[model samples]
Every structure is written in C-alpha cells, then in structure tokens.
Target: MSRRTVLVTGATGTTGSRVLAGLRQRGVAVRPASRRGAPAFDWGDQDTWVDALVDIDTLYVVPPIEDSPTGVPRGMGDISGFCKYAVKQGVDRFVLLSARSGRAGNPEVVAVEDVVKALGVEWTILRPSAFHQNFAENFQLNSANPLRQSIVDGSLEAMDLGSPIDFIDAADIADVAVETLVGTGHHGQTYELSGPRAFPFAEAVRIIARTLDRPIQYTEFQPTAWFERLRATGVDETVIGLVEHVLHSHDSGVFAGEFDTVERLLQRPPRSFEAYVRETAALGVWDMNQAANKAMQHQR
Candidate 1:
C-alpha cells in the first residue's frame, strides 16, 4: 500500500495536537492543517479545503467550535459541505473527534457525524469525556500556581457540578484515535471514551492537594455565580459560555458515566487521574513555592 497521508484538522489544538503527535510517532505521513499552517485550512473558508484535502487517503477531523460576535458558542454550521468535498477528492477513511454528549444527539455534533456517514466512506467517531488536562492546562487551578488574583481574595474557586465526572486523559483519546484511523474493525463504531472511573470535582481537588502537598480547597458555585466570577476576571464571554455548558452538563449528570472503551480499544487500562497527577507532580507543575513566587511577582 502507498504511504497513508492523513490530514489532521485543528492540528494545533489540544486533542488534535496529541493526535498529530501520535500519528507522527507511528511513522505515518501526516499533513497538519490549521488556519495558519502551510496548506492552510479554515472551517469558515471553503476555498481552503481542497488544498488541505489533496492526495489524502485518511482524515482526522476536529470540528471547530466558534464564538459568535455576541459571545455565544457556535458550532460548525454544516460540515456536510466539507465532507462531500473531501469524498470527491478521494479521501477514504475518517476519524472524527466528537464529545460524549454528541452520542445523545447533540444537534451540532450529530450534523457532522451524519455527513460523514452519508458520504459512504469508512468512519469512526470518538466521543470523549472532559479531558483531565483541563485542570493543568485550561482551568489553571491544578497548578499550585498562584491564582491570577490571590487565593486569599477568594478569586479562584473550583466549580462543583454536584456529580462525578469521568475525566479521560488526552493521550488516551489520541491512542484510540490512532488505532481507529489505521486499524480495522472500527468502521461504523461510535466509541464513548472515558477514564476508568468517575470522581467528583472535590475528589480531584483532594488528589491535587495530596499529591502536591499543598492546601487546595474546592468550592461549589451555582452556574450563575460561576458565570459572574469568570466575567469578573475578564474572561472572554465565549469561553465562559463553553465552560458553563460543560459544567452545566456535568451538573445534569451528562459526564458522570464511565466507559470501558478506552481499555477495550487500547487493550490496556486507561490512565487514572491519580497517575496523571503523580506524573504531573514529578514535573514540578504543582510546586506551591513556584506558584507563590510567580503570584508575588505579578503583584509587584
């Protein structure tokens, strides 16, 4: 078989970046596509699609979640246009990065999945729960790193959804994505990827505190309170909306379920939250002294 050149959209993003790295590590030919990358690709600009699709036999798609000018979260309106275009250009296999909620018929995600399936190509959909890296990367609390505002001022609070969440590691998601993309027997499969167990947000805080040997408290906030808190910090409304959506979904028990798909597909147990925390701690990512020094510097 000729070398497979897989086009990975959203190549620079969290999960997409991991997927790209995994593909590269496996020695598969990959074309990383982003708005600014060479052979650039943009969801809103149809004209840029063909170049990104050129000579590609496999595709890894991460649909863009855009922010409306008014601050609401918006989905890729209709990916069918791009899906049909890719089919005509000769791409044969597809792996879509969708959310766990999408399996329950989230309209936007369903629209994209529908298009891929209707295109008559081999396809696999990965629906993963919230990523564990959200704490270290997006939320910023997992870091013993000083809160943008001093923790003394109560400026930083962990939003509790009043439920347990199955937080999967991004690396695990990438592993499954690679397998589905290059391996067989996954066609027409919609796997709900998650960590081995579900734990409440409070438990996550405790884990960080124990692993880092720091005092970290978990605070429960109503959706409205959390929204106002983020706004007060000058967080973008679009990002706040996305956060609210996920937290609210958690509150509603949307992410409370665990899945064995990760283990089943990878043929090994999914990495646990504790393992992630232990490894991260070893990296000194949660050093309290370092965070405090950074905070003090910012204050000065």
Candidate 2:
C-alpha cells in the first residue's frame, strides 16, 4: 500500500507553513505546493496545480490571493477554475483556510467546496480569526514604518467577524489540519478556531509589556484625533485611508465574537495575547517601543 500524500497549497504562509510543520512532526507525507516551493503549485498557474494534485489524496486549500478582502494580486475568477480542475482529477479530502468574516459560506469558497463535495471528496473547513502573526509579519508593525499611535481599546467585537473569533495561533490551526490529514475524527465537520480568551487591545498591550518588560501602551483614538496625529507624522494618504477603514470597521462593532476555540480544537487552550506579545518581543519580532522610540529619538 502506498502512503497517503497530503498537498498543501500556499505552503509559505503563516497557516500553511504550520500545517506543513505539523504534518511532518506526525510523520505524514506532505507535499508543499507553492510557486517557489517543493511541489510547485501556483494557485493561478493551472499546470502546477494539476501536476501537484497527481496521486495526492488530500489538499489544504488556502485560496488564491485575489479572493482576499485585502485584495490579492491574482487574476480574476481564480477560485472557480481551480475547483473545476481539481474535481476532474481524482483528488480527495480538501481542507480550506477561510477568513472568519468572509467565511459566511460565501459563493467563493462555498462554490469550490460544493464541487469537491460533488466529486465525493472528504472535506473540512477551518475559519480562523485575525492571526497574531499579523503583528510580526504584516505591515502593521511599529518598526517598519515609524509612527506614534495613541490608539487604544483595540477590542474588536466578534460577531461582525462573521463568527466568534478566539484568534487561534497559526501553529494550532496547523496542528488541526495535520490531525485531520493523519487522524480520522475531523472529516465531516467545520471547525472555528480562536484563542481561549479575548481581551481588548489595551489589555493585550499591557500583556505585551508584562511579557517583554517594555513599557508599551495602547491608547484609544477617535477618527479625528487619529487623522490629526497621522498627519503630523506625515503618514501617507493611502496608508491613512486603510488604517481608518480598519478602525472604522472595528469601532462600528463588526467583530463582536472574540474568545476560546483553540482549546476546543487542540484539547489545550490556545496561547494568550500576552504570550504572543512577549514571545515576539523577546525574539525581536517587533520592539513594541521601537516605533514611538524612533519618533521620540528623531524629535529630540
């Protein structure tokens, strides 16, 4: 009997990489399919997807970039095309990495899922909230673009997020993905993962300070006050608009469901915001004080 091979699309990302790592730790055969990675499956590039899907029993679909709300650079209608082709081939077991807010069973992911289901493939869907890795990898950090932010109460209500988001660590999400691949229990269910507890941004920042021993703070900023401060810092108009959009959304109560799905999935509670802040801080992932620190140094 041949060993089952699991193909992971988007192999380089936060969730995908963790999936790969988790699978490897459990001794499952994982073929990473990404443009520059081992199996060479580019979501936009059809030939690559077909090549990688050969003899593959399971797939972790992270979706092509264009489907993302932040707007990816991929071409139009990428999702439909990928599913059509995957079904033609005999690939089975598709696990999708869908957004917490967008996963309202959108025509997008749902459409592909439907196709896979029609093909009689086993499926599991994971809708996870905003990742903690965002603080380190995304454009939101203080070091990359220096800014003095007084924004506080970063508490996002979770229902607007399309569901309660316990904000599961990418690593935990990966563990579940690998478990589904290796173990049999999660085949027909959809799992929503989040951290054990949800705290507002101010409290989250305080945890960062406690963990890193840095005096970092989270200050609340109204739109007007935020605009003025960003203007003084000479923040670009484009960047300012995006920040405003996020703030407006959060403040308006779009994300109301925040707290504890990670523990539910992993049987162990997810890491806390403080652990993320502290761990990242100790690792120089971001100097919580680095941004304002730079602003202060330059002002003197």
Q: What are the per-residue Cα lDDT tens digits for candidate 2 across 127-190?
A: 6666666555643212342211321122222112212224456777788777766667666676
Per-residue accuracy of model 1 over 174-284 as CA lDDT, tens digit each: 999988887888889989999999988778777877776767655666778867876897889867655655556666777877889988888999999999988977876
Model 1 spans > 4 angstroms off: 1-3, 68-75, 138-156, 227-248, 292-300
lDDT of every predicted structure (CA atoms) = 0.76, 0.60
Q: Which regions in candidate 2 have their CA more than 4 angstroms from the true location?
A: 1-3, 66-76, 103-119, 138-165, 217-261, 288-300
Quote the lDDT for 27 in model 1: 94
| Candidate 1 weakest ten by summed lDDT | 140-149
Per-residue lDDT of 58 in model 1: 93
Which is the leading candidate under TM-score? 1
Task: Quote model 2's TM-score.
Answer: 0.71
**TM-scores for candidates 1 onward, in order:** 0.82, 0.71
